[model samples]
Target: MNYFTRVLKYGIDYSYFGLLNILFNILYAIFSALAFVSFIPMLDVLFKQTEIVYTKPEYTGIGNIREYLESYFNYYLSNQLETDVSSTLIIVVGIVVFFFLMKNIFNYLALYNITFVKNGLLKNLRENLYSKVLNMPISYFLNKKKGDLMSRITADILEIQTSYLSILELMVREPLTILFTLIVMFTISPRLTLFVTLFIPISGFIISIIGKKLRKDSKEVQQQQSNFLSIIDETISGQKVIKSFLSESFFLDKFKSINSLLFKFSNKVINRKNLAGPFSEFMGILVIGVLLWFGGKMVLISETISGTTFIVFMGLAYNILTPAKNLSKSFYSIKKGNAAAERVFEIIEYNNDRVDQKRDVELIKFENKITFENIEFNYGDSKILDKISFTINKGESVALVGSSGSGKTTIANILNGFFNPKSGNLLIDNNNISQITKESLYKNISIVTQESILFNDSILNNIKIGNLDTKKEDVINAAKEANAHEFIEQQLDGYNTMIGDYGNKLSGGQKQRLTIARAMLKSPSILILDEATSSLDSKSEKKIQDAINKLMQGKTSLIIAHKFSTIKKCDKIILIDKGKIIAQGTHEELINSNSSYKNMNELQI
Candidate 1:
């Protein structure tokens, strides 16, 4: 109930449909009551209770109107030449038709208003959730499971929109209608109403017992479903690896086991949830039978309630039980929605680890020095970098040479502000990096990593993502500079040729060159290249290095050197070992002065 109440507040202020919805539902209840009340006259006609036993009319103002109408009707009936059965039959038929029409029209309008409220809130809620995901800090995504996050964005929010919204509307409207119907039943016979109320607690207890198992099973089903989706995503993305390793049957077995578990849990949840409907209706019919027997005996002995009155009272009692049975269903749906809402809110409520100050430093350009002072970082208990320090002048190229796991990529990540050092500080032109806004910091740096990220878009559009407003000629120029223009022009559509997901349609070298072209378009003050040419052949590497040399002109660059030729061209080379700088000098100077650099250089050759 707390979750339902909280979620409603999110929509109530955002749209006026909440107000409209409540108004129409109330109108629906009123008209439904009036429709049933119209039966009183019909029952009187059938039971011969419409004789003129007149009393004086006394009223004031608009309150006098009903008495006036009643007196007029009685006067007309009394003066009629004949009181015939055929005329009464026609009158009863007219009353039934009129009441049925009123009931349906009001019901239609109530359902219509609900459609507007549900779709409007759903639109706004999805938009807000998407905006929150995009604006949250990068660190927030690192600790989350992609499949569970996907479930929140796709399945859980949709459950809130579908089941939760429907249940909420029913919880409000049906209960009010039930209450009004109960009041009418009491007016007809208080003894019968009391007898009905005695079964209320018993029906509620049964519903509660059945629904108690629903939430736990619902949670389990949701978890298994997410795991299944994750496995599918993994298999699709790594299809080549799976095929190469010949583990298709192994993965299939794993998937089948997970699917079986999901099926079992889903059966449990639905079985428990679905019991509320028929079981509740059965109990309701039982109560109605009990009422009939007791009320029939009372009617035989009592003069106040005729058989016709008793029959109409029974109809109203059945109407009350209809909504009561529906109430049990709505409660079950709310419990299911509670499980979904918990997962959805978990993602939207996670605390982003990166904090921004009230105000941040803004630098239009880089001028002085970029310094890493005694930096340390750990991913949980495993330290990735330790007490590392380095500096780069405004317009110089510095390369870091190391084997795998020697912290080359980590340094590149730290420089691009993708990660924050756990200890010590980084400075740009003497101002602390933490003081700068992420947008401003990113404006001064560009990265081209080993994996070339490209969307499924035209080559022209892909490069233009570096700067959306970049002109066509500008894209071609950047492409030429990366040595991608010659190959791209050879394609059938030239720059307009579509690159598939992750640029799968292109070769490794071609994708890397396109990535380099994207970075070239940014024209950043600092460029960080993390083994960007590692996937290319020597021929492609040479072409890319030539492009890199041209691109690094007048820009401070940190190259995570994979090629011996590229390392020798840097103004200085730093040898890193175990997250620390063990040697620093020219390629020739290091080779002369440091054993580690000589060994690495010799190994590369």
Candidate 2:
């Protein structure tokens, strides 16, 4: 379906609230017209045009209800004029004030009800976007910018709220107000009303032509904004690298370039949007001028309409312009809103190729082994892993040794179900890994990466993230096992110490130890260490290595290490070169047999 249809579908899902707004708006429109129409009688009283009646007027059937009400009102006013002309004018003024008050009251109620639906839709849209982002596979984010996704969720959604969602008011109140005003105008003078109708289509056609470029311009503005936001995110995230390289001016130039494009697109969009209001207003006044010339001739020459009635018709005609202008603006806003909704729905409706299938069997524990049978994976068109086959038996620690681009980390990613091979069957205990749910598979495995990923939270909460229900004693014990307890205890608040963003307040060693502590708390059946200690100093490496040894005991482990010394004691080592496994043996066996393995080991030593 089209974007507009999709947006309307979302609004219709909350039709209960929308219906309430519509009902109140209908009342508001009716009362608003009556409030202006009440001016007709007051004008008569002021101009001394009251028709005096000697007796009460007879009630007529509903078919002639309009005439009957007019007669009844005249009879009451005539009697009041005879008694006290000043008092009769006072009563007419009171009735006019009452109608206006009721009109405003209904208008307020309409807006109040619409607010609930508008805000509620925005809340649901954001929530759904977040949930989809969380569930998307890792590969989905590989090509996406953090800032672009962030813009979709924040600024783009807000644009939809203000531009599109606010159109809810125009949809109900403005159209109904114009519709009711037309009915009153037609009753006063059909000839002038028909003349007004002819110009409406012409004005609408002109306004639509002006707005033809709005959606395209709005899309450009939103895209430029996303680009600007992406640059900001990249700049902040890589501030350290930029500062270390003394490339501040380089990034500043990049930001200014994108910002300039954003400013240009914004100007174009606003120029088009602002044009709608004035153009519609001018067209409306032109219509009014024509109506005055024609309707005045009918009143003064043809004598078809009275002076007071013609004045009321003019008021109704002017009132129609307000809603008409609002309707035109709403159309422009819908175009912008449609553009934003397209961006939002792109993320929400993205097809996740790596979605897990429903699994009836739960992988509660790893018993036998994890095997990769003839695995072949590709990154775009280039092969990353080719016919790679290996197995790590239960409680065995196997290290994958390879060059930087030799797909060692890809194996770890596949093992954790973050990705699936293009052609392979990964099995645990002879059961296909794809048949196992990711949640249950991840529950039995834990990973520690080269970079420590920590939040800006208390150390206690950070450690507890591995297992929320973990006890305080268990957290301390895990920290102790990772050789982190001593440093943690030295802090002012110990476990309760608030770690600044990404644990920036802590040293590299301390941060790595905290991550190890988190993994240790999970205590999974299988563990994958992807150069977890590669970034630490020798002293910190030794401490973390000791923790790794403690955590790896009696657990099936896969190690991807840059330093051969870290994995020298593994049960076996698989040496890969350019997406193919060249050899597999213990370190001593590889050193004696394989030249590639011997050379790598020599360089590290």
Candidate 3:
């Protein structure tokens, strides 16, 4: 469906609250019009033009209710005046005050009910947006900017709340207020009401022109804001590299350019939105000016309407201006909100081709072996893995050794079910891995990557994330096994020591050990180490390598190693070159038989 239709559908989902709002708003509008209409009799009293009446007014049909109301007021005023003229004036003033008070009370209730629907829709929209982002495939985010996604969730949703959700108030309350006011105006004088209606279309046509331009500019403003946010995110993430290269000016210039565009587009949208209020007011005054001339002539020359009724009609006409201005502004806001809704829905409705299909089988347990049968994988059009086949039997530690781009890491990714191969089957225990639910598949496996991914939390908390139910003793034991217990104990708070973002507070070796400690806590049946110790110094490497050995004991392991020293003692080594396996053997066997393996081993040495 179109974006506007989608926005209305979101409102329809919460129609219960909207309907309540409508009921209150209708009451508010009727009271509001009656409050202004109450002034008609007060005007008659002030002018000493109260009509003389001896008997109660007779009942009349709806068409003559205005005449009936006027006659009844005259009948009461005549009685009150005979006793005390001051008391008659007091009663008229009291009636006017009561109508005004009731009008405001109903107005407040309309706003109260509208607030619930507004906030409820916003809460649902944000939750759904975040859930969709979490469940989307990893590949879907390969090209997406973190800031763009963040903008969609945060700023874009806020825009929809202000522009779209607030439309409900304008749609129900404002239009009904105008309608009620016009009914009173028509009752007072239909000729004057007819004259006012003729000029409304003209004002609407002008407002529509401004709104058309506002929508186009509003979409650009939102897009530019997303771009600006992306730049800020990239700058913050790569601050180290930017500072090291002394390229701060370059990024500053880029930010300034995006910010400048945002400023210009925003100015256009605001200018257009602001114009609606003043322009509608001006058009309203023009109509009122014409009415004053024509209606005043009718009162004085033709004597078709009274002075007090004409004054009340004028009050109602001016009252219509406020809702008219609001209606015009609401139109502009809906246009802007429609743009934001499109961006939000784009992510919420994203088709993640990589999401696992429904699997009714019980949770998978890794038993025999993981086999890659003729695996062929491509990224875009570039072949990353081609017709490759291998197997790692249960409790065996096999290292995948290859050049930088020879598909070693791709094997780890596919095996971990992060991506599916273009043409292949990764079988776990003779059962297709694709048939296993991702949660079930991942429960039996753990991965430690080259970079340590840690949150800004305590050391104990980070480790506990692997298994929330793990005991303190078990966590300490896991840390001891990973060789991290020593350094952790040295910290002021020991296990409770706060690790900063990405574990930046710790040394590379300390961070790697903690990650190993985390994985050790998981104690999975299978483990994948993707150059887990590649960035560590020799001393740290030896410590982490010892931990790796301890963690790999009696577990099925896949090691993608760049350093020959790291995987030299594996049960077997599969040497890959340019997406295809060229050889598989022990280190000595490969050194004796394969030139490529010998050359890589020599280069590392």
Candidate 4:
């Protein structure tokens, strides 16, 4: 489907609003033509061209209705003129004013109804983008920039909203205005109306050529916008790195380059889009000039069209220009918005192949064990985990310790279903992990990662995120067990105190402890700790390690830690090197038997 058509589908749910909008627009179109047509009688009166009808006209069929109405109106004018010409002129002007007022009222009503459809589409589109982002697997975002994704969700969607108004109006309002006006023009003089209608396709074809170029340029503008936004994101996130290396000039130059591209392409799109309005108006005026010459000859020489009627025909022709210019504007707008629409719909329609295809099996508990059998995974051509296998029985705490880039975190991620192994099976109590329903599997599992992840929300809310039904006392108890209760209570708002972005308001240890408390509150039967204390100092590490141990009690735990001290008490420790497990044993047994494990332990100690 065309990208614009796909976006229009989102408004289907607001059909009633669209129906009302179309109805009111029909009324507006009728009145819009009537508003200008009403002045024809006044013009006739001014020109002393009003025929005095002594007898009222009889009712006629639809074909002669225009002639009948004209005669009746002449009869009324003649009677009124006999009394007073000034009063009759005032009455004619009054009728014209009434038609103009009705035209605007119906136009306002049409816009009021379309507002519901417009705002509703925006709301629903934002929600769909957000929900898609949330459900999308971690691997899906590996090749995408966070800042680019942010731009698609925010700026590009806004572009779609602005263009959507033009689309809706183009559908019913503008065309109807032109249609009704043309019908009246045809009635006054078919030759002039045909002449005007012939000019339309030529004007449209010219505007279309410009629009085609604008589409390509508009895409470049949107892409450049994404590039600058990505640079901004990187600059903000790596500010410390840039400042530490004294490389502000390098980043500034980098941003300026992308920003310059954005500025150039944006101006191109804007300049081309602006051409549409003026060109359309100029074409309308050109056609109007031809009408004046052609119709003036008919009125004066041929005497086929009357002088007063020709003047009224000119008024109707001018009325057609406003809708003509707006329709052209809509054409250019859709061309530009097509780029943004494609960007946004790409995310919404992303094929996340990592989502488990077989989700019928429920994993309500970790009753027996988790077994990784012949697991193989890769990032493109580079292997991250190869033919790997390990197991952790229920209620047993197992640790994976390895050097950096040795696949410890990768293994933990695979176990957590964040990434599917290229070839292998992960089993929970003999049930294929990939087949387990995500909701049920997640319900039984909790993870505390190396970096403390907390929202900018109250302390109590952060802990209660995944476990919203947990009572306050249970939260406090969980906090106490994780060694976070003292610092949390020390804050002015206690549990209600707000944590800043990524919990930056708290110390490294406080952040880590709060994460532990959040995990403990869930009370999951299976827990995974991926270097929960790697960045903390020894003092903080000891406090967090104590919390981890307590959170692991009676729970089947998988720990990926670099600091061997944190996992020494695990039931089994697996040492991995270069995507392969070199040894697996209890810490004491590994220290006694494996020289690699012994050296790593000695080095850390």
On TM-score, the candidate that comes out on top is: 4
When 1 and 4 are scored with TM-score, the better candidate is 4
Model 1 lDDT tens row, 477-538: 99999999999999889999998888899988888889889989999999998888878888
Give the Cα error of residue 551 in candidate 4, in Å.
0.4
Q: Higher-TM-score candidate among 1 and 3?
A: 3
Clashes of each: 0, 0, 0, 0
- Could you give the C-alpha RMSD of every candidate to the true structure, in order shown? 2.8, 1.9, 2.3, 1.3
Query: Which stretches of model 1 miss by more than 4 angstroms?
Result: 47-49, 53-91, 486-497
Q: How far is candidate 1 from the true structure (C-alpha RMSD, Å)?
A: 2.8
Please give me the total number of clashing residue pairs in predicted model 4: 0
Each candidate's lDDT (Cα)? 0.80, 0.89, 0.88, 0.89
Question: Which has the better lDDT: candidate 1, or candidate 2?
Answer: 2
Query: Candidate 3: global Cα-lDDT?
Result: 0.88
Model 3 TM-score on a 0 to 1 scale: 0.94
Q: lDDT winner between 1 and 4, please give it.
A: 4
Q: Compared with the true structure, what per-residue lDDT tens digits does model 3 show for residues 498-564?
A: 9898888999999999889999999899999999988889999999999999999989999988898
In model 4, residue pairs whose N, Cα or C atoms come closer than 3 Å (at least 3 residues apart or on different chains), thus clashing, are none
Worst 10 residues of 4 by lDDT: 162-171
Work out the TM-score per prediction: 0.92, 0.96, 0.94, 0.98
Worst 10 residues of 2 by lDDT: 352-361
Candidate 3 has its poorest 10 consecutive residues by lDDT at 353-362
